[model samples]
Target: MGIVVVEICDSNFLLSLNIEEIIESKYPEVAVLFNDCLGFCGLCRLKPYAMVNGKRIHGKTPEECLEKIKEAIEAELAFYA
Candidate 1:
């Protein structure tokens, strides 16, 4: 019913994949924000990750992380439905 906030670190390797475009195009109600730092310690440097509705979702690879992010978003949307 409301916007789903997906926050990613600006320095995250996932950015190189144009994740913002991919996610926003797929989910109109989702907002993908690339912040300077997500304050997850140094985890951003080690893996692909995103904060979906304040929940941390990460994966070994960027592609995997993107899929998990979508799944997390879908799960959140289901509650509204």
Candidate 2:
């Protein structure tokens, strides 16, 4: 499969949940990047969200968002497979 870029804002709540470790451990092919600012305005401050292969994925809670991110990653990888 090809590389799946998962971009998350540094201030996102997902970081508090060790999202980087969780994603890397679960999907070694996924490159999770934490940037100082994703340029999404104030979205990061209100909810859990990330960019999966350039597609925005978000949820009301961190756990929910993480699940969505995984789904998006799988979908993106499927395109290569």
Candidate 3:
């Protein structure tokens, strides 16, 4: 995989997965940042999601969002392949 930019909400209560660790271990090339807020507090406060390559990937739960994010990452990396 190539460079994947991910930004996630810093609130632990809202997410069901340890996003940073999961992606770091599985996709070493991805650069993920956890911020206090991504200016999408309204959405971030409601669902589990990540901004992958600037695209918003969302899911009702963390596991689902993580999978979606991974798919998005693969798709973006494919462009470089």
Candidate 4:
């Protein structure tokens, strides 16, 4: 099993997702970390932005963002396997 970490910064929308809850529900092994600022203001301005394994996703809804993150995590796990 691999560890998944979600870092949320200044983005209010991202914070609203309650990422910890979602990750724990779906990916138990995955760990989510909420930070103050990822320093990606340009992307944050787009709203509902997140970084999935270091890749930036901009202007996403909570559901959409979670889906993308899950997909990325699955892909990472597959690579390890």
Candidate 5:
């Protein structure tokens, strides 16, 4: 399988989690990047926003987005695995 890249932008604690660090530490095959804006202002206004493999996810809290991202990533991984 290929690398799974999760791009997060302009979030509060979600960005603070150092997602890149966490992903690199736990799943070396996964690459996480943090940016300023994802060009989805509506979603950004929701606070925690992330792009998992090019799919946009917006939520009120980091935890909310994190759960969804994990599920999505796992599903994607399972497909290729």
Candidate 6:
């Protein structure tokens, strides 16, 4: 099994959601990195977003973003799994 890397900027955590916690709890072999900065300040501060497999994924709402992030992870995991 390979580890999936999820990069999240440490700018603003939208809607008080714990992204790292969610990812850790959902995926088995995964690395959730609360990176210092992913160089996306506007996106990070505005809405809920994450970088899965180096791809930016964002959502209108926190819940939606969480689900999308999970979906992105699953999609990436599919390739490696």
lDDT tens readout by residue for model 3, 1-81: 338888888863335666778887888888888888888757877888888888989887777788889999889888877
* Candidate 6 lDDT over residue span 4-80, tens digit each: 78888777564378777777887877788877788986878888788887888888888898888888888887888
lDDT of 3: 0.79
TM-score of each: 0.94, 0.94, 0.86, 0.76, 0.76, 0.85
lDDT of 2: 0.91
Instruction: Quote model 4's TM-score.
Output: 0.76
With a 3 Å backbone cut-off (N, CA, C), the pairs that clash in candidate 4 are none
Clashes counted in candidate 4 amount to 0
The per-residue C-alpha lDDT of model 3 at residue 81 equals 73
Candidate 4: residue 37 lDDT (0-100): 80
lDDT of each: 0.90, 0.91, 0.79, 0.68, 0.71, 0.78
Q: Return the TM-score for candidate 2, rounded to 2 decimals.
A: 0.94
* Clash count in backbone of candidate 5: 0
- Candidate 6 lDDT trough over 10 residues, lowest sum: 12-21
Off by over 4 Å in 4: none
lDDT of 5 by residue, 38-66 (tens): 77766665577678789876566777777
Give candidate 5 misplaced runs (Cα > 4 Å): 11-13
Residue pairs clashing, model 1: none
Tell me the tens digit of each residue's lDDT in model 2 across 1-81: 339999999889888688988998988899888899999999999999999988999999999999999999989889888
